[model samples]
Target: MKQIFTLGTLAAACIIACAPAVADTATQPTASAGATSAASTSESRKLNKLADEYWDALARFDPVSAGESGDNRYADQIGMSIAPKNRAHQFALYRDYLKRLHTIRRDGLAQRDQTSYDILDYELTTALRFEPFPEHLLPLNQMDALPVTLANYSSGQQAQPLATVKDYRAYLNRLTQLGPWIDQAIANMREGMKTGVVQPKAVMVAALPQFKQLVAAKAEDSIYYTPVKNFPSGFSDADKKKLAAAYRSTIAGRLNPALKRLADFVEHDYLPACRTSTGWSALPHGMDWYLARVASQTTTDLQPEQIHQIGLKEVARIQGEYARIGPKMGYNGPASGLPTWVSEQAKYKPFKTEGEIIDVYRKLNAQLQTKLPALFSLRPKTPLDLRLEPELSRATASDHYTPPAADGSRPGVFWSVVNDPTEYGSTGMVTLFLHEGQPGHHFHIALMQELGLPDFRKFGGNNAFTEGWALYAETLGTEMGLYDKPEDWFGHLNDEMLRAVRLVVDTGMHAKGWTREQSIQYMRETLGYTEAAARNATERYMAWPAQALGYKIGALKIQELRARAEKELGPKFSLPKFHEIVLGEGTLPLALLEKKVDRWIAESK
Candidate 1:
């Protein structure tokens, strides 16, 4: 419903992209109503059409996302990146969609239709605001571990399949598009730099290895050729030969050269210019920009100062919980005063091999499943798994979660970085699983799709509500009885420390003008992270700026609300029903979420 900074020349193009409202979730957004103005119906229909266009476009935008979700429409369309022209077109569609959505008198629509329209408006506008900001251009970043996304395609278990002759061709097309995309990515980054919008120095360092891996000389040596070695059975020899040749040419002639260009630019030019500060505030209008992002992420009108204060309040409350547990564990303060106990904690060691690390997580995930029903009435229908973060992308990557496709073809995954397990700190596994796997991201995201809501809301998430949910899930271990064990309780504390530290350091860097070193130091002192992990997180902050601020600020709000509901509902409060209330509407702006929950609680009473 709100507008982002307009794209001047591309503004018209963006208007069309904006028209779809909620692309993935809104196709069947609402119940149809009888008797409306012909013009109003036409506009509503136009907005609805975006659901189809968005899937078609999204399948194009990220073929892996499409294939993983079992939408075979894009199954064969891989190897091509989004053409800027498509972006220009979508931009216009989105802008116009927003305009048309507003013109309708919302209350005139049926209840379901009205709600769908509200959600559609929010998702479309968020997409529009995000589009022209060069995010479309710089697709490869340290975040998703881009190189790993490629490696997983080769790994056979992930989204990009190794099934058909058609599948191989799909990848070839993907390879063909890589070089041009890289060029576009670099051009965009450079352009961003012109406006003081450069990535943090830490992120630039992370991008280097991806370039090096892709630029390798022989086609077989490249990760793309990996699947070529283990092709699916029953393929014709001639087709194999043809596929192999096409891949070799694409990798050697197109992909490798592009990598060389990017690597050379990164090591030789871009790194030097990367900003030393970790916050988005370093960019032009950076403060205003971060505030907008915070708003978008949380889906709320809370200002940065409000979120910051909320973060402080939540940190103190969590510390009290930690204090109650610390004496039982033989530690007194929330501060054992860093070094001695921090390093000496037995769980703070590394895995000897990558397999061991992956195995540990697999075991933990399985452990949780056996106990899940006692605490959660709602869970993901999708299966869950743990995988090693691919070696090629581990240097700059962190542990992450990738939710299953709506169709259930690909299982939700918890990927751990095996780059240097010692650096990762072993103590956080249980808490991490709850956040990324069990009651955290996987459940939240998967259920959004399962709910009978507009597709727009189904697939969309507010960062504050989403990540906040994960962080809050970390604390739920106690209620589930998992935290009765001292070690698991410690894991919860360690994770909370990480998020609380994020509040202090993320604010310190962007708001208070702390240097990158200062931010890293603050984390090291507070979070019990290794120096290396601290460095990685600080750099991530530099690139993403205020994104780190969302977790604690968000989780605290949910925890507070839950407490309020419990006291008010008293004997009548049902945890399962309460959870349904929290998740039932899908992710909303925090304010909307609170209002909706208040209504539910009042009616339940």
Candidate 2:
């Protein structure tokens, strides 16, 4: 199923549920407290059973998640997460679950069972901590607005199924269901305005066209019109005609008006009232919210200032590396000028067609496949595909990977943002593939799903491990022979530099009260981001605090672990074995990961 909490879900992402739900295992009671007692073992099993039931209930309540999980039982249900009543009920469920979990004796469980208990407890508590905040009021970001994701779903081109008559009807149900939710979304934003918890005007402005596109003047113009035009082959003409008529009526009558209402609300009301300040600290309890986000995203208690210092050190190191390679690229300047020179260099962007861009990705895949055996013994059996982002969503879409369907119907897909060919630089393509495709998300996410682990462990992830492993994967370019040339190496380092800059800038904006302009200027000066790119990147961090920090922080930790394993194991160190241990258990918090690596080291020795 899609992530029970998607990285794109505005409410979840805003509340930090998208991050790894890790808690203080020491303070919380675990079955290990029972010291191998039979009662403890029984309690652990009971808790496991309860955890499964909890997930099953959660999956049922979240329709998009249900469909993504490869379960179609709740395909017809569309949840109104932004509604006040819905939030209240969800919070109630979380409390009830936590209460039930606490009743279970954690003192007698085994190590594995204890870990599961801690994870579940953490997930529930992390979820509960946000209940006091009015995050639902600011549910739409430029990047992950509910309307945009719904449009993709209703279009029958995404995770939503459209194989049969029932599937078509299911989507129709979903569209009808979304109308009230969209209405509630507007109402929530209205509440946000009153409480000063609304999204920034810049973010709201970015979201304007997305809502406008959904509110088509003609039924045929609507994204929802896609299903009617492409009926299933097995559908009889009578059935197709009836469904088409129903869809057109639904689009024109219910959906179009609902979307128009939302579009008007956003443009006329929300936009003007949206906050001008970019930082979260500008809002009520904004600093605390940002702090919570930092802790959740990094899975650490490191303060923003500490992370900022770390970022500065990392930026300095990466700049030194970038400077060393400057003369090779025909530039002889100080490290500080490298970003500007890279921005000015036109030779880096070579692809003239969408085909040319995709060709490079496919070639990169082929190259990585051949070199896989040297570093990774456990490669994903699930196939990976490279495809362009749909033209409609290309405006906001960035290069990303979609994990394979849990049931294996869909292969892992690497979606390239090929909107404008000239804008697409060839220099970063190798590093991009390394991070998003093979041995990156495609490898890490698929392996978790492939293993018959607990539902939470399989699909649930912390941003740090998920993004960290991918960034760390970029560093693997050297070992895999992908970054052989200076340009390719430059691409890798340039991307690394951006992640480091994220540390400085994300904290600078939220904690230090840096203006949006200041953050954008820093990105352009330090990381070679273009003006447009800098604004977009800065806005993303503004929309979601501490999330950008995950890439560099995660990558550094993984690299550190690898170095420790290598140094301690000496000749006994096995690259493939080390990889197996790191990735075998799917995503973990950095602390747990370090412990796992330490254990592997001791065992190897």
Candidate 3:
């Protein structure tokens, strides 16, 4: 999972869905005296000031997101974002910004400023559309919830810093608020039961162990005790003792009991009320909600049926490639048999220890560095580091990338989850590294942060662009000569197939009334995944609807643009320049990206 903090989505359409309003506002007549160049300059200045103010207000509004991006001013605060009063205030803030934004004349601004205006408008409009939906009712899930985020912070290895005495005290202050947050979360879940917006029963069952793991009998045994055990070497014994005592008291008095209460609430009160139906359509007004998710996630107006058809076509196409390669690997079996044959081979599972797994990725990083300059004129200055996933998150987590801090305090890290070395497959290693490590997320995200763009573009993302870029990066493996072996190529296709499978399964469950078991069985037959792998994949989609649709949708769009550039430009084309154009601006919605690429092609001619 690539960690992206996406803004909300528009209802049932692309960003262009809101363009008529912008167009109307832009064309309104201006007063004759106020229509001079001075007026244009004033509007531009006002827009710039608004951008700055919005970023600052957002930092205070969602401090965790700000802290992750390397803003430390609000490190001690965790606002009650889900509470009704706070939610209302946040919506009012968006409405105010949007109202002020419309007063600026978009037609009079510079091209760059015009782009920023459109992006900000899209974000505000999309966010406001979600006001009718009650996302606050379900605050936590088996994956990517507040608890998982907080636990990652406690390790002292994530975005939260523990480098000084002040840093330690700030964290303690943050923990003091956890009890209330948990209580509110439980209260919200209870409200959800009445409103018919609850999570699936299986997801709640899966989340129980996560809460249980955090309820330790003693503070010293808690995961939050991590910082206390590894104090900075410069700390005097007196300071260390005092900080440790404070941590122990906070964890025992505030954190542990809160965690236990949450665990008990889920087990006793919430489980019986969870919805057994797997898809979003089962809830109130769910079909509309799922449609909104589709538009927002893919940044397109693609309907569920349209996306499902596209997935089917892509799956068939990839399966043909698999059949073509299967003969060369000395296996004349059917394309569906390829995954099993590859997995059963002892040669692919050679690692006896975790160290060997890390070594394999390090070597891939070294090999990739020498090949990057040939294809990319724009590369990130931020370094990419490899680390194993922490023990607590490893069970539920996949291999993922975390972006570097804005202040350069931390480097981007690719966490490889090595649960059991002997069971880890090696063929996927090359493509996995390509997708999560180097020229994939690290290159795109780190470079975006490094660019001199608006704060929203730097920190905000569209899932289609982010995941699509990573999936497209996997295809670059072939051009880079990383997939020299038949097995390696098979791994690439298999991973692609998983994304394709997601298109079928995600919509099937959420829009077409597919059961969890039905989805799991379809994955096993198509990708040759074991029952456990298939189940995990199904549950992930169940937890996050329409998110999986972005990978293949975004990748195909990029590939389409590249092919168009190649055919039109012929000998005049430069791969590096084309890449620069696609990635030069920070992340864009798919429609905006198409317009940008088309403009670049026209200019080059």
Top TM-score: which candidate number?
3
Q: Model 3, 495-527: lDDT tens per residue?
A: 999999999999999999999999999999889
Q: Candidate 3 — which residues are off by over 4 angstroms?
A: 6-40, 69-72
Query: In model 2, which range of ten residues has the least summed lDDT?
Result: 1-10
Query: Of the pair 2 and 3, which is ahead by lDDT?
Result: 3
Q: What is the lDDT of residue 83 in candidate 3?
A: 76
Candidate 1 residue spans exceeding 4 A from truth:
1-47, 54-87, 103-105, 108-110, 128-141, 144-148, 193-195, 316-324, 332-340, 347-367, 387-397, 416-426
- For model 3 the local lDDT of residue 287 reads 90
Better of 1 and 3 by TM-score: 3
Q: Give the C-alpha lDDT of model 3.
A: 0.82
TM-score of each: 0.84, 0.93, 0.94
Instruction: Give per-residue CA lDDT, model 2, range 1-605, as digits (tens).
Output: 12223432322422244234344334445344346587776787789787877666566556676555445567787777667777777778778888999888775665566667766776677677677777778777776666677677654546777778998988888888778878888888888888888888998787788788777879987888887877778899999988888888888888889888988999999999988898988989989888877877786778899999999998899888887988888889888787677757788877689999998888888877788888998888889988888776676667888777776667888888888898677778899888999889888988888777687667566778888899999888898777878888888988888899999999999999899999999887887677888998888888877878878888889999999999999988999999998898777777677767887788678
Candidate no. 1 TM-score: 0.84
